[model samples]
Target chain A: MRILVVDDMVTMRKIIKTQLTKLGYTDITEADDGTTAVEAIKIAVSSGQPYDLIISDWNMPNMSGLDLLKAIKSTAEIANTPFLMVTAEAEQKSIIEAIKSGVSNYIVKPFTPDTLQEKIKKIIPNPVK
Target chain B: MPIKVPKTLHPFINAVEKTFKILCFLDVTPGDPIIKNHKVSDKSISGIVGMVGSKYIGSFVISFTAECILNIVQKMLGEKYTEVNDAVSDTVAEITNIVFGNAKKELADMNITLEMAIPYTIRGNNHIITHKTDGPYVVIPFSSSLGTFTIEMGMEPKKKDRRG
Candidate 1:
């Protein structure tokens, strides 16, 4: 399965990518910001090889992960894709907002590799091994 | 020196302890809280993030010496570095983002609705951070097995807000 990781911070992107790699994921792509991620997702869908999973940071430079999730949920073509939201803070209000926006799962920052794997497993039970 | 830290600053103190422990696997011990003037600078590298609330606005800064930062990064990413570079600076920004984000949650529990923007990383010798607010800065020092670091915070409450 293909995955797209979107984060504004290079370090975070690298960290997540590394963790995902260790979890047996090889077909992974990265987008620096939410705007770019939207374009990338659209391109992937148009090319007939849409990403199976999207992991995005909640706070970004251009568009936030919530907005990106909303856009994907509103668009019929990519609405079904699984989305994992990464954030540093998990306030109740924001968590409810993300849930309402149709996020598959959410994880807080400074999480361990085991925690990441657990969260991913909950979303993608039969992910590419 | 043992100083009386404001209750508002406790969230930040908690953020630092939790972030460092989880991310870098370091046992961090909080030192005394030093209240200072409007502007303060420490160490060689710093990650600064600005925060704004309906009733208050301020900045949170985390500073580390070159040795301290490098040690922390090595433990965090499982990589060693001798000098501060773009990658190291990027790590600093991420740390500030996570720590501040963690603090915002507790602050919200106290009825303070604060929004966090991206963080800026500064590197050099004795780089100064001049906060925009007129409020006093609270510089809290922390120590770990790796090294030492400090977090400075300041907030300016609006005129109508009695509790800053």
Candidate 2:
């Protein structure tokens, strides 16, 4: 499945990409922040390589993960795409906001591969074993 | 439930310990949190990242001396930092983000979840970050062979919503 991992930090993006690869996912793309992520999504759809899932961070310059998620869900073509918000925001209100925004799942920061995989499986229908 | 001071503080210490070990290849031991009204020179590099999720709305700040920061980035990049520049600044921010991320994970079990914000660094002296709520700040100090550093956690515990 094609996945888009968004974060402003290069090291973090690299870490997520590495983890995705370890999870047996080969088709992954990256964006540095919300604005770029939105553009990337548009391009992907225009090229017929729509992302199957979106993993985003909450705080970023230009736009944040919450904004990015809102943009994705507002668009009909990508609205159904599974979105997993992986962040270090440990507040109940933020989680509620994410849920209200239609996020498929939320994973807190410093999560292990096992937790990430579990959330992915729960959100994606019949994910690869 | 409010986080018990001691229990709530352990994860932060562990995160700092683990981060130094992994990134700087240095061992660390956390000292008592300096909560007294002692003054610390703010003329150090400060990296701040916001946290959002199930039970906390706060941020983490890592402050260190310029020389100490250079040493850390040197270790992180596997090379010596000759001067302070964008590369060193970026490295410090990344290190802070990693440590915060690690700490957030351990705190999750206590019904605390966090969304990470972009990491940004400031270089100067005599800077102090006050928590939004009038709560005591937990200042965790660590000593390592490279140098000494501190992790300051300014957080307000999440309050359960009655409607939910």
* Per-model B-chain TM-score: 0.92, 0.81
Model 2, global lDDT: 0.74
Cα shift from native, residue B30, model 2 (Å): 0.5
- Candidate 2 regions exceeding 4 Å error are A125-129, B1-27, B33-44, B49-60, B64-88, B94-119, B124-139, B144-147, B153-164
* Candidate 1: clashing pairs of residues: none
Q: Give model 2's TM-score versus the native structure.
A: 0.67
DockQ for model 1?
Answer: 0.77
* Residue range B34-145, candidate 1, lDDT tens digits: 8877464658899999888899888899999899999988888878999999999999999999999999999999999898688898888868785657757888898888
Ten consecutive residues with minimal summed lDDT in candidate 2 chain B?
A: B34-43
In the range A1-129, model 1's lDDT, one tens digit per residue, is 999999989889988988888888889999998888888998999999999999999988779999999999998988999999999977999999999999999999978878998988899987775
Candidate 1 chain A: 10-residue stretch with minimal lDDT: A120-129
lDDT of 2 by residue, A1-129 (tens): 899999887655765776788789889898888988888998999899888889887767788888999999898877888899977655567789999999999986656567778889888867753
